[model samples]
Target: MADDYIIRTEGLTKQFKGFVAVRDVTLNVRRGTIHALIGPNGAGKTTVFNLVTKFLEPSAGRIVYNGDDITGSKPADIALKGMVRSFQISAVFPHLSVLENVRIALQRPTGLSFRFWKPDSVLDGLNDKARTLLRDVGLEEFEPVMAGELPYGRKRALEIATTLALDPELMLLDEPMAGMGHEDISRVSALIKTVAKNRTVLMVEHNLNVVSDLSDTITVLQRGEILAEGTYDEVSANPDVREAYMGTGHD
Candidate 1:
């Protein structure tokens, strides 16, 4: 049963000048499921994410991934272990074409990341795989377009495509649907679902509807600690969750 969990944290805590940002939080992300973390502003969602991904060190805690204690691992180390985090903002080379951006991402796994001096033809071998990722994210039509020229929503889709190029086993998405209209949200939501079929996803999102639709499990945080966690229906019905998350008039 231990193998069922891809990542787990025990007594995770973080502090800044004696101010506790995350306190004794324990989380278990199951293998092959979409897990969501949601909370109000300053609820420490990002802090927890940083800690888990090893961008920030925990003051007290242990992070275990695939049965290994990775509490002391670096960000790149964790990434090499198949846990990769996509940034909250779109991260792609503006000057590059959409296909180029994904080709660069694919280079890392092929030992070509720092070989900038290599002829462009050396990267041509990566184009087919990059195009496949673009098609996977529904951006094949825009492959030749400048990444900066694409609309905002499409940029996010491009970002996802690049992340997928890394071949992450567990993808950590930070607000994958942060800024988008209804249509973009719908498209990206479906893409997330399709990509999740073979890999696990752990996302921090503010959109309750998106969370409700995609998450197999949800964890609610408040004041740097877990307030409630369960399926959407279970947490939505809790009186405390209603008061804290949905507010008094939300019913």
Candidate 2:
């Protein structure tokens, strides 16, 4: 499926004031591929995510998703088109039960117009679906627990489950492994691999080892531009990437 890239960006850029946060970064994330974006601090990795997810409008360039141009589309509109993002921070409702959190996300896609009448059957069906999602992320045990009370990793898993409710074709994850301990990281990594089996994932991560393990392709960014892009070995072997990783006077 290399020839059928699900997401493509052509000279995509984002500028804030006089500073360019993302510069002419063209990329192709092949269908069903796990593409990892890695770079040092201030390398504009998160900015690229922002641009791709429509959280920030691009200053220039075009974005093609499933071969359709969506460069300037609004975030909600883009999400409705089967592209969704999971932020670095958890977006789950703190007060809602774990199952309810996922249920709310499921409700978004359905045109639920009848609010006054009791939705007993609808609620039951949604409950079953939400449980399935929780089970997917290994959070089924905490379905009745308050979302805010779950462990850090479990909270993150809930967030991912909520995102899954959108049934996204392309999922943009910003540092999914952020703030996780070794055990938590391992769990999340497994969950990521499971989810990626059916959805295309493009993640920005700082852990090189994790990137190498999870990515079918890798892209290195520096100062708001793409430094290199290829498989782990190909990009790691690139002279520019080595220099970027080594930093000045370190090599």
Candidate 3:
């Protein structure tokens, strides 16, 4: 049987100079599903992601992934364990082709310097795998195009392809749909759904429509604490959740 939870945290907390950013926040992300973490600004969603990824040390908490304690693990350690976080800060190579960008990520497990010393013929073999990832993200046609020249949404797709090169079991995306037009949103929403078919996804998105459509589970936070946790239909109907969203315009 599948593990009860792929990722879990108990009493997770973060303090910034005595100000609590996230406090006593427990989260459970089941294996093989799309889970969303959502809240208004300053509600500590990203902070929770940081703590899970070990990007920031939690003030007090235990992070367990696949039933192992990872609270003291480093960022790379968590990544190696199949938990990868795609930062909101962007991961695309502005000057490289889509194929080259993905190949670079594919070579990460193999040292970059070693690849540099190998024959161009051997390096060319990475193209097939790169193309497969591009295909998965619907960027196969753009493989030879410059990553930066693609439209914003396509660039995001290319970034997602780069992340896929690592073959993560649990993918954490921070604001995957941050700034996009309706067309881009549709394309990306479709792409996210496609990639998430086999792997688990945990994303922090402000788009409630996407949340409602993609999430199997939703955890709502307000003022650094969980206000509600359940299906979209369940949480959206909660009076307290409605009040929090209405008061802060969370969606």
Per-residue C-alpha lDDT of model 2 across residues 135-166, encoded as one tens digit per residue: 99999899889988999999999999999988
Give every collision pair in model 3.
none
Preferred candidate (lDDT higher): 1 or 2: 1
Instruction: Summarize candidate 3's per-residue lDDT along 148-192 as a digit string, tens digits.
Output: 899888888888898888889999999888888889878877888
The TM-score that candidate 1 achieves is 0.96
Full-model lDDT for every candidate: 0.89, 0.86, 0.86
Rank the candidate models, highest TM-score first.
1, 3, 2
- Candidate 1 collision pairs: none
Q: How many clashing pairs per prediction, in order?
A: 0, 0, 0
Runs in model 3 lying further than 4 Å from the true structure: 110-119, 247-251
Superposed model 1: Cα runs more than 4 Å off: 248-251
